[model samples]
Every structure is written in structure tokens, then in C-alpha cells.
Target: MGGKSRALPPTRGTLIERLRDPATAPAAYEALVAAYWKPVYAQLRRRLGLGNEDAKDLTQAFFTHVVERGSLARYDRERARFRTWLSRLLESFAANEHARSQAQKRGGGTAHVSIDPESADHRLGASAPVAADEVVESFEREWRRALFEDALEAFRARCVELGKPQRFDLLLRADVTEVPPDGSRPSYRTLATEFGLELTQVTNELHAARRELRACVLDALRARCVDEDDFAHERRALEGSDREIER
Candidate 1:
């Protein structure tokens, strides 16, 4: 470690319980919506053939319904992953065209978090409408991307706090940044020259940075899970790698 050590970010060990607890449910719902809203919006657009405004309104309304109805409190982690359960709920919500219309007319209330369409819409871009099954397939990919993005942001902020932002820059260039067309990364010697460090120092810094990033990613990933088993399963599926999600 080349800088002051910091504790890992918060993890929600009792996510299920917190969602069920009235006192904690608001905050829990906020975190849940923030994590899943993009995928929900995307699925609504693709699976239901809704335009951006309709999808955005429906997304906001769906989460509002969930929060008002205590829908997440009914989630049984043993039955399905949180995302799968939420997807089912979204499908039900989207199926009710009358309800969707009403929600849109009323201008869907804020659902414990702001539903920003601009960023999600930009990323979704203009693609031919995908099938319902394809929407489901893409949902998992979107969720995985969100996980790593949250992790990377947390890691970057932590590096700043530790006065080792260069460590993150080094890691980003060496690993996170796009590689050459031939799939080659900058050599360690090259990185050393760029960062003004010895090769040994570069190696040590990268190792430590990677370890910290893994911790940050784990924190983000685990916070969305209901229990230890769920976290373990997800960690295994991620395969202990830091590869960027292919859009």
C-alpha cells in the first residue's frame, strides 16, 4: 500500500430485512431503485415497444407502485435472485396498459429516487426493437455493467481521498482503458516511464490498486444481494475478473 489505507464502502448485509422494515425501507428502496432503474427502463422500451417518454414515465410509476405497495418486502431470495423477482414485477406492471396510461397522465411521482432518462437513453441509443427474450438477456448484462461502474466510481473517489489518484490512473491505463486493436496493453516498463516510477514500484502499486478495486466492486455487488449465498453465487459468476462490460 503506497497511501493511507481506507475502509471498504458500506455493504447491506440485511438488505431483505431492511426493505421490510418501515424505518429503513425508504433508504433501502432508494438504493434499490438507483441500482435497477436503468435496466427496468430499458426492458420497458424493448419488451413493450414504448417510446422514451412512455418508458421513462412507466419506469418511474412502476417503482412508485413498488414503494407504495411494499412489493420488495415480499421478495424471497430463496425463490429467485432479486433482479429476477424485480423483472417479474416489472412485467406485471408493464402488462397493465390502462394503469400505465393513468400513471403517465398523473406524471408519475418520484419513486424514492430521481429517474433520469437522459443518461440511460443516451446509452440505449437508437437500436431496432429487440424481442422480449432479448430484453431479458440484456437485463443481466446491464446489471453487471452497473455493478462495475459503481465499483469503479467508489474506487476512484477512495483514491482521491487517499491522495493516490495516480494509482487509479495507472490502473485505468494499464487495465481498464481500451487496449490496442491487437489487444495489447502498455508494457509495465512503458507505464513506469509514464508514471515516473520504477518497474518494481509500478508492479507493487498495481497489485495494491487491483486488490482495493476488487474490494470496492465486492462492496457494490454485495449490497444488492439479499444474503451470503446470493453474494457468493454472484461473485462466482463474475469469475473474479475486472473485464469491462462489452456494450
Candidate 2:
């Protein structure tokens, strides 16, 4: 029998480590913004009681500050979770910026940061009322949602690369949503008929696709951890919710 295959290296690294490396910092910062901007924007809007436009500008400015300051590189993994650290950082930045905006108004000078309101709305939806105490919870929720979305996209791309697009679609239809698009749920038999495969084949393909998705998600989460313990903690936090893979 052949020995077990070695696990592949993670596709990326923790944001802090990436920010420290000049070669990887640019791409890593882009990924960080894509993964985090929504939550950060939403949190800012809610916590600061700012209008949509103001929130958007501040969010853009925050990312600019991060890039200029190499803020992620300053994160100490032992001190706090990245999300916690970021929430505090954003709060401080928002307060300081708000004060600066007031000072600028007094001096009659204007400052602006370009942000796409439509994009922000599409990602975060209509602004809902959130209690001040719940801001942290809201940020964590959005962060997890974004992380899962990234993982799902990565899984889809991997499926395409592996020539298993049908398998990926089948799994999404079967496990992620209602297949019939109506009141009734579809069964293995129904899926087999729809996909023109044997019932056993349908079952096998879905199983494989789900396994691959789990691996992809794990790899994503692993990239955010600074050490084995951090990775394990994040894995539990991710899998601890209602979004566990269906058997």
C-alpha cells in the first residue's frame, strides 16, 4: 500500500506575518481588505452613528492608514484575537478622525476619501439598529460570514481546477440550498435524475465535494492563525456554529 499523502501547505499566511514581508504585503493587504472591509464598514457605521457616506469614507481611510502604518504587523497574537484587536483599533481611529473632521470644519478645510456606497450597501445591506454593546458581536458575525464566503469561493475555484464543477454545483444545490426551488426538498434519487447520474454516484460525488470544501475552509482558517493552538481555536470557532458540513 502507498503511504498517506502529505498535506499541502496553506495557500496563505497570518495577516501579521504577511504584512511584515515586503514581497507579500501588497497582495496580502488586498486580500485583507476584501475579506474585512464589509465588517469594518458596518461596524463603523453602527458604532459611530455616522451616515452611509461618512462611514464609507472612514472605512477607506482606515484601510489607507493600515497600509501606511503597517498596522497588521503590529498585532500581537498572544495579546488578543485579530478581530478584537481590529475592533479596538477601528474605534480609536474613528474617534480620532471624527475629532479631526470637527477641527477641519472649524478651519474651513475639507478632506475626502473615495468609497463606493453601492458596493458597501450590496455587501452589508440596509443599516439596521444595533445596540452599542452589540457592535463587537456584529463585527464578529460579519467577519465569520466573510471568511466562509472566501472559503466557498476558494472551494469553487479548486473544483473547477480539478474538473469537478458539476460535483461542486451538486453539493451546493443539495446541501447549501433547496434544490427544487419550492416547498419540497430534493432527495438523492431526485438529484441523480436531475444530474443524469446513478443514485450512488450522486451520493459519492456530493461526499467528495463536501470533503473538499471542508479542507478548503480549514486551509483558509489556518492561514489566519499564528500557531497550532491559534489554528485549533479558530477551527473550533468556525465549526462551532450552525454551519457545520452536512453528512
Best by lDDT: 1
Model 1 residue pairs with clashes: none
Q: How far is candidate 1 from the true structure (C-alpha RMSD, Å)?
A: 8.0
TM per candidate comes to 0.74, 0.70
For candidate 2, write residues 206-240 as lDDT tens digits: 88888888988787666545556677777777777
Which residue pairs show collisions in model 2? none
Name the weakest run of 10 consecutive residues (lDDT summed) in model 1: 1-10
| lDDT per residue (tens digit) for residues 56-172 in model 1 | 777788889987887866777779877778777776776685465557768794333333686356436645565555555667766777677778889999999999999999999
Q: With candidate 1 superimposed using the best TM-score fit, by how many Å does residue 67's alpha carbon deviate from the native?
A: 2.5
- Candidate 2 local Cα displacement, residue 83, angstroms: 2.2
lDDT (Cα atoms) of all candidates against the true structure: 0.73, 0.71
Angstrom error of the Cα, residue 126, model 2: value is 1.8
Off by over 4 Å in 2: 1-14, 21-24, 45-57, 70-74, 95-125, 178-185, 241-247
Which ranges of candidate 1 are over 4 A from the true structure?
1-13, 45-56, 95-124, 240-247
